[model samples]
Target: MDWIAEMTDEDTALWRSDLGLIADAARQAGDVALGYFNQSPEVWWKNEGRSPVSAADFAANQKLESILRAARPDYGWLSEETDDDGDRLSRETLFIIDPIDGTRAFLAGQDLWCVSVAVVRHGRPVAGVLYAPALEEFYEAVEGGVALKNGRPITVSTTPLDAPGRFAIAEDVLKAFPEALKHRIERVRHVPSLAYRIAMVADGQIDGTFVKHNSHDWDLAAADLILERAGGRLVDLQGEAPLYNRIQVSHGELCAATAPRLADLLRGIGERRGS
Candidate 1:
């Protein structure tokens, strides 16, 4: 439960190595996605059209799962491309992956898509990596450790959340709120990928994100851990820590910020949303 004592120097080194290997696997997965990008092999929906998943996602998942399992067979696997395999619960460490985080963007030939990877232990993320192959940017973090982009250390900007800082949010964020707050914050940018949006916050490209419900553990786990390591935080609008790998994988509305200003944003958002 404690991060300071758990993340020793030795632990950091080992996580760093694992992150590099996972990044390589992610890059390979991105290469698989590239083959079908814009070519549109097939597009379909599961359940209620929550989101679109393509053949490329499965292909990239296969490539990534193959590489990771080959290297570390004992680690459990959890991925968006495959059906939920309950067997992962028996292992102490699990690999949570999103092969193509921004499938919509990728299918549209946008370069904002990415491959996200994370190692979780006892319901907490210990290491995380995100690779945007088209953009050639790699981001990673070890728990209680540094966040890096392309092997260079990165930190979130200490910008005030109430100020005119950039905000990245899902398309439905405003729709879920009352007219008062919905019309109050007009500078919101909608991004297709959760991990990419979190990365933007870690690198100070964006100030914050207001995420409505319905994101899964695999979608935000890696990015959440990375943002914390980069001097930022992702918490529920009610000011509680975000949990992972629960029976209900769906997450609640969240507010992410580089500084403690998340409290201010979340308070206002909560009132508007009647949460």
Candidate 2:
């Protein structure tokens, strides 16, 4: 059954309400982050110095947590800037958020960062929003609805797999592609925000991207629904969609593209791995 078919009228209304809630909360968090954007908001290293978290991240996370949790006291919460207390796994629906995606880019005075928020039901997202204050772009999607950017509908690129296409992927990952495959694709510059990169694919600005291993739920949950609603797929190598609010919040190598293109990309990756 389709996602909407599985939901009752009350469930659909609730998701739509949740969509509005997150969209507003995301924008508020974006504003909080923007206040620190280029001001060099006190940086701290986490994940053993491999990742940077700034005051802006904390500030925005606080804003999102306060607004979202207060509004939906019954919903569980999980965020990049907050400690995961294992509470979300108990709730049938929960909030997954990244206060400021692309902290490095934000610190570098780049406009690629955003506030990402989603409402996940059971194990999949039912509503999602990505708000880029610097770019003045707001992308939102709810199950059974079209993906929207600034209120306009968006869709993934329809480029055939055989045609040359554009992608935002790491150089090392691209190098592993067979020469024939490499020649048929254009490697776009790296985007620091994985969420924004996937949204680009959703809006047809890029054909697809590869998500490296260790990406957490907050990085993908919001954009996953946006891309899916835009008629694209974000799946792991096994062709399985991600399940959120689980004990393990991390994901392995994944790809995002339109269905047919995703299949071709997966096949190419598999062939390269087998060689």
Candidate 3:
């Protein structure tokens, strides 16, 4: 059964309440991170120095964990800053969190970072929020509700599928496209936060983006729901949406765009692979 279709009135009401909870939690986490942003809040290397973590990330994570866990003790927790205890796998619902989505950007004083939080039920997100304190942009969505940005509904760009459009994708990936198609895509400057990049697509700031492989649930759960409610999608090469809070949290190469645009983008990618 489709989980969303199976949601009863009580389920919907509960998810909406969870949305409010996460929205406030995200804002609080963002505020904590912002306090150390650009102040060089002591950096540390993780994943063998391939990724950077800051004191700000931990502070924000602490704030989110404290606020969210206390509010919903039964909900499981998965966060980028916390070591996975594997306990969340048994829970029916859990909080997927990225306390600081763009730690590198935050350290550099860039405003593209955000605090991302989502409530996942039965492997899908029910409520999600992305709060960029530096940018002052708050995005949120819940199951059976419209996407919102600071109280206003938001949607993906209405750009025609065949027309030239902007994308947040790496130049190398763009080069894989047919020359004609490559020229039609205007690559935007890199936005350090993967979650914020997807949020841009949801808000119509960009048409789409290509997310490289190895993106984790915390990096995507919140933004995925926001983008979906905004009339777009974030799907893997197979055109399948992600399932969250699984034993394995990482994902493969993915694409995000409005339905029609995503079809075209995926076609181009398939062509690149076929050749």
Candidate 4:
């Protein structure tokens, strides 16, 4: 299937309005996060130590939920900090949200955290915004317009697969790649927020990155649209883009990169998967 489709003029205007609404709400959510950034907030763990949540997260989540739901009460809601309702799967459109995508980084006083929100219709993201107040960066996209970072357009890198490049990858995933591909990988680090990592790829701050198994829809939704609009693509290892707000919001191995490099990474890994 095509990554994005041609939108009619009417649809374009509608998506643009959605983008504007989400951006304002996201910025407000970011402000709520700022109130708790770098200060100790009640911290807790989730998924048996696989993840974290803090008071800042809930504050931001409540702010976003109140704003967005007031504006679009009919839209479904799926958020990292909220309990999911089976009702979201039935809506034609919904908001997928993560009030604080990089809680660990935020807790560590790093500037990598962000507020991510997206509008998905028919399983595809039509509008999205990623606002990182700590980093002073805001990335946004609508179906018919170019992606932007703080009012400036953004795009992915063209760094070749054979060229040295920085990547965000799990140690185990990197080790699984063949040595030839491994040699091309450079400046690797673990990023706490999957959304921020994808945003970095869209803005060309890094070459590319990989997602491990079981990343949720809230983690990937907004940034996925930004990367795609910025001339990059985030997709499953099988070369298909993600569909958000499914009956199950979980996803398997995913990758994000400029189009050509994405194909290159997949081919390298697919061949090895068979060996």
Q: Provide the RMSD of all predictions against the true structure, rounded to 1 decimal.
A: 2.5, 1.3, 1.0, 1.7
TM-score of 1: 0.89
The CA lDDT of each predicted structure is 0.81, 0.93, 0.92, 0.90
Tens-place lDDT digits, model 4, residues 1-275: 25346557887888899999999999999999999997899999998998889999999999999999999999999999999889998898999999999898999999889999999998989999999998899999988689999999998987766687788888888888888788877756777888999999999989899888898999999999999899999988888998888888899999998887787789878867973
User: Residue pairs in steric clash, candidate 3?
Assistant: none
On residues 49-115, what C-alpha lDDT tens digit does candidate 1 reach at each position? 9678889998999999999989889888888887886788888778999999998898888989899
Name the regions of candidate 4 deviating beyond 4 angstroms.
Answer: 1-6
Best by TM-score: 3
Top candidate, metric lDDT? 2
Sort order, TM-score high to low:
3, 2, 4, 1
Candidate 2 local Cα displacement, residue 236, angstroms: 0.4
Deviation of model 3 at 263, angstroms: 0.4
Residue pairs in collision within model 1: none
- Estimate, for each residue in 1-275, the C-alpha lDDT of model 3 and write its tens digit: 28788789999999999998999888888888888977878899999899999899999999999999999999999999999988999999999999999888888888889999999999989999999999899999998899999999999999986688899999899988877678668899999999999999999999999999999999999999999999999999889999999899999999999888788888888888883
Residue pairs with clashing backbones, model 2: none
- Candidate 3 — number of clashing residue pairs? 0
Model 1, poorest ten-residue lDDT window? 180-189
